[model samples]
Target: MMINSDNLCMSCMKDIGTEKQCPYCGFHADSKQIEPYLPIRTVLGNRYLVGKLLEYNGDGATYMGLDLSTRESVNIREFFPENIAQRDPKTLGVFVMPEKETIYNECLQSFTEMWRKLMRLSGLSALIKVRDILEGNGTCYAITENIDGITLREYLLRNNVGYISWEKARPLLMPVLSTLGTLHASGIIHRGISPSTLVVAPDGKIRITGFSISPVRSARSELKCQLYNGYAAFEQYGFEGRQGTWTDIYGFGAVLYRTLIGTDPIDATERVTNDRLMVPGKFAEQLPAYVINGLVNALQIMPEDRTRTVEELRAELSASPSAVAGTGVEYEPVVPVTVKKPVAQRIVDEEDEEDYTYNKREAAKKRHNRSSAVIAVCAIIIVLAIAFLVLWQTGVIKIDNDTTTTAAAETVEVPNFVGKPYSEIVDNTYNTKNFTFEKNEVYNSTVEEGYVISQSVDVNKKVPVGTTIRLEVSKGKESIVFPTGGIIGTKYEDAQKYLTRLGFKVEKSIKLNLDNEIPDTVQGFSLEEGVSYEKGTTVFLFVWSEPETTAPEEEPTSEDETTLDDIVDDTIDKIINFGRGN
Candidate 1:
């Protein structure tokens, strides 16, 4: 329950019905951040209290809100497609631009489908949680549980001071990789898996945050999706490119590359022209060869050459001696031969605050070390002279020394637990006798519903034989049920949103205007919108048709276009008539 207190300061999630002032920061709620939209202190859907305008990502304007029912802080993401549609200040109706009406409706449908998909994925723990989806201010609001953690970018900068060793990074990456693998297998691609999107929770857990249907993608019928230059894959840039699971893999690889190297790799667009990306091993020899190879393979510019799946990438990243041998890299379980260099301390200007006493202290310590070395040398010489004198006086010397030691415990090999059944592993005879196991059930895309997807302990590792290992078991894909609610007569957008919000999938079609009916209004539904159905039941919606407008009659300005050809044809006709008369 480590909530990100950074965004929560604007309002007390615990005190949902409190005063207008922000409980933590004491900032007035009347601060109007964005314009041409809902003003400050506007309570959306009558329950979530709007606090502050968090950000204006390309797709929507996000607001930190408080849910009264749960009394928890939540991020309310509004589907404000500012490019194609806008909210009318006076009436508060979402009006699509006259030219972009068709695309607007399509984008709206896509938004609905995206939220529905998210609702279906509650089994995936690392995926951001969605509390509720509601219509507000003539647009849709997706309420997600607020996460409390620093971004991976912040963690890298603050904790690592720039970059970290592979040993430290391996553990940090496993949880995210496991979650992302399930997402990919469930036919979901993050599309945006940059350092900023990953949160390192206060409890040292990884929570992938910032889910936005990037509005700048050109490949699909939908207009545009948000695209990051350095992080986006090659296919995501244009309509001709084929985007798939590999698309997200590229972004994930880019983030991995960026974090490991402390710098952004070449942008996908630029990589096509000239790729000079230095491998991790090339830049840092101390890193494991397998990890270096894994990173390099993941960052391949072409999807065909790239690590095609999350499992493939994970296997490479978690490569053992045999795994590295399969990849043609020399396998050695010992420390790297290259000497690792310590991170250099930053140089400061003479007048800089960090320069004053620290420099003096460092210099004094070096001088003291030199003086101590000289004193020690003199003392050693005097001791040697005294020892020689004693030996001469005694004419003979005798010495004796004795040592005692104890034998160490013999170590035994750890067992392989990959793809093991959770039920059997938990209450198994061998499991109880030799080792202890901790099991967690999570949604797995490739692994069977009851089998283990991953284990914390390495297989065949000799560690006093009975080492306790933590295992993550798969529950398969979680089923989503369409919720039932009253939506007999609502606005077409409202109806689609209503059905969608209630977990009932919707398919809409406008009826032909044989009777000159109104357009974009909920005319009828194939099934009763009030009645609940099983999850993923698509309810076809019939919208009222708009009267077709005839194009204005064009002026007769085309008379001269047939001039030369018409005159020639007339002459030929006259000759033919003369010949017939003769």
Candidate 2:
């Protein structure tokens, strides 16, 4: 069966000719998209062919797209903060209210900058890969690889128990944890890490999607917040709350709670008022003690009380009663204790009040009797001892002495610190007094700055308490003198690779050319060639492109443009497409 690439279905990207309904995906081709969303088959960057709108949030809209160059499917994310920005149907460009222009532009930059960082940090197994970023239509677009899988929500629903055991979930979630730690190190915090943002592939691996700017995920920003009730941290609910790694920790803990308890935890706001979210006794019994403790601490309502780092959360999960005995931190397992009476219960009924009074009197009487008995027994024992002592004074008693022994010093295993952020570990080691860290700074190409490159003590080696472990922290890659004259006239692709290889962030912008010149070649650069620049410096390249040719214009109807109301309503229902893509 032959398929026409030009006549592809917007819903599934499959070929469907002349039929109003797609046979493959069961999508009605004639069904119109809502206002403010990209129209079906809209082309972007002269390469990506945007299909149906997949999902939208406070930050932007995501669409199913096809990479025209490769004919492969991709996910396109557009920056369109609804609360502060509006769309011009005539020009397909976004405009903001004059007063909110600054905030809108700031958030837009944040959206693009976050994606740029993610683009550089791609290839982590637990994270969706960001492929390319381009600017147009008064906004930014991030192109990411599409995942063929279902959301974690659906995955849990498909399971018989609607949950998984700790053993089954540990391997699946550890990658996400590690990836989060890396993201935090890179100054990126994913405030939205709920089940809907997590995708489970056919291989049974979970990958995180739905990345957005801070304002979109937090409350009281210029944009409307799209926070997951049970997954969002308490700090995200208020503008004055300071958020850090702990914000993501709360979401991560909520995810684990859902994965193990077979239900969503109570919303953070509700928990703040009336905290009734606890793991069921049945599920708690099924999980490891350390795991339950880890979940509780990570899901604390207050950020100060919550697990502050992925490393700490992992430690809690891996610890045992014996392992943490002398670590100064107690990991108490959750047990369902039955209390005969409520600690704060009040007796309102006459009969209940009378019974309580009677019980109190009975308890006092029993205490008095026990004290009298103890005192009488002690007097009799003292009298007997006095008589015996008097006899012993006459040399009637003899005693034997035995040798005493001294206990050995306590020892603890040295923890692995290589490749960890030195700042995170220093405080713990110093406070615990188990080991002392002697820090040294050095330049390294492989290790990230502020991270431990090497440690003097071997990991897992049993050492006595107060051992001084020398650590060398990375100062990041050493600065290098820019190479002379090799970056000017090369092709854009070649130049990008060259600049990136020399430790610089390369950004390319298309320069339209009417004069006969090489297309896709570098026309100019933002930085001078022979100057010393620090690693990770952004270098912009002006690339020549073919002159624009006039094409038949398509008028955008009311249904083709997305309104603020459309985005607001769509956000509430966007979870339906969580399994679709980013």
Candidate 3:
């Protein structure tokens, strides 16, 4: 944070002297090593004073500057890729070699369009505030409001002990998702969202910057991507890969991985074959299992394999029992650990308020942990005290009504039932007298199916000779049974509702197989009209494709659809279902 009223360091947005390299921030005022940079105090457009060379980037170098027109401090980005063009020191104008002129112009257009698109999102709060754009000094310049903030990377290195608990990480990331969602809705792909691009402003709001330096793709499928080893997704490595929301999803996941693990995750390219990157749970075992599961799924190298949107990734993070509480703390494991999510595909493209019985089950997975260590300790103390009283009452310590001497030592500490094979521990941990064991099977993504996910009572606690304890065993991931009832001839929406209640994501694809007259009913589904699929699986619903324009010339005159309205209904159904994706 070097700032001087007279001069400033461009790289750090700090105030330093006019020298070859900044003495205070180490910014190169005359960066001639990799490429020649503008000297200190160089003026752009005759109205902006360049103070110091900030830092070099893939597309250009950013610098600290002053707007002589308005007398305001600003940060400026200069487009100068040495591979494509050269800056004429005498004229301060960019000149491209004839052979490379085409690529240079196209890339320059992409760089300019990137900012114009950002300009459309002026109201978005999570975006770093910008001031203006200028064309001069042999390259374009993107000047933004001077921000003295710390990059998320710097903040992590300085503040993180290791993994910032979910308690602290969720709130920090939620706003980012909401912002990306807005960007997606705007049809803009941020292709850049790593720890380095995210900054925490002085106002405590996290803003994403470095938009001007986004890589410009060439016609040859060559991607000159801004590489941040662990943070860049696999698709970014080449032009053949599909780049979209999923690309950013991987970057966001990698950032979380670094935050949670206190180590850099392996690059997506390496994981395509090896997949040796450690899962989030391995580093923070106590983290709600969904967080681990989400990170793993998001980092999938295959674009189709990753969660498709920021919303989905956010949901996966919030899927944990702790996140639903929205208390910003990881809840104890008193309830089932795994939360059901729509597998990996999106049935609903956008946020729809439509009702689905399938989503309701999501609210039932949260409950407080009933067996903490303190309660276990107290239970032991009470049990031991009760035993002594029983001995006295039975005349072991004192004479009883019949003066008979009897002694009994019948008490044992409750054995830990969590994480053990339910079958192996059930008979041994149960008490014969007052206590009993109740077995419950629940779908848990983290714990192995048939293993114990949680126990009703704490371990190491003495409960009389027997106390009833219930164990929730992992049933693995959830499955859904598509109801076979009344789906035929039902409105598509109605079928969507019915199947959703059965715990499946419902999708409609135009039926390639259609009848001539029109189709008023759902012909069939991809699988059995009624069958089971893993929960979160997308159930494809098929409907007849719409007929060509004009009323089919003459109705099919089919027996059931003998009337005119029947013909209309079928055509309408086709028209509606035709709009849905396959």
Candidate 3 on 1-582: residue-level lDDT in tens? 222335555455455655556776665554322225666667777666776555553477777778776767787778776556777777767888668777777778777776766667767788875667787654687777777888887888887385576777878877877888887787777766778789878877778776633353111222223556677777776635677888778878888877777887776656666666654344546666667657766777777556778877777777756544443334233322122332332433334533223332334343223346568889999999899999988878864477765456455456555765566553321132225779888898667667787788887676654567889998977867767667766767878887788787888877653347346457678766456678877878777666645554665556645678878998989988889842
TM-score of each: 0.52, 0.56, 0.52
Clash number for each model: 12, 5, 11
Better of 2 and 3 by lDDT: 2
Candidate that would win on lDDT: 2
Per-residue alpha-carbon lDDT of candidate 1 for residues 471-494, written as tens digits (9 for 90 to 100)? 898887544544344444466888
Off by over 4 Å in 2: 1-4, 324-582
Clashes of 1: 12
Q: Tell me how candidate 3 scores on lDDT.
A: 0.66
Tell me the lDDT of model 2 at 57.
Answer: 64
Arrange candidates by TM-score, highest first: which order? 2, 1, 3
Deviation from native of the Cα of residue 525 in model 1, angstroms: 74
> Which scores better on TM-score, 2 or 3?
2
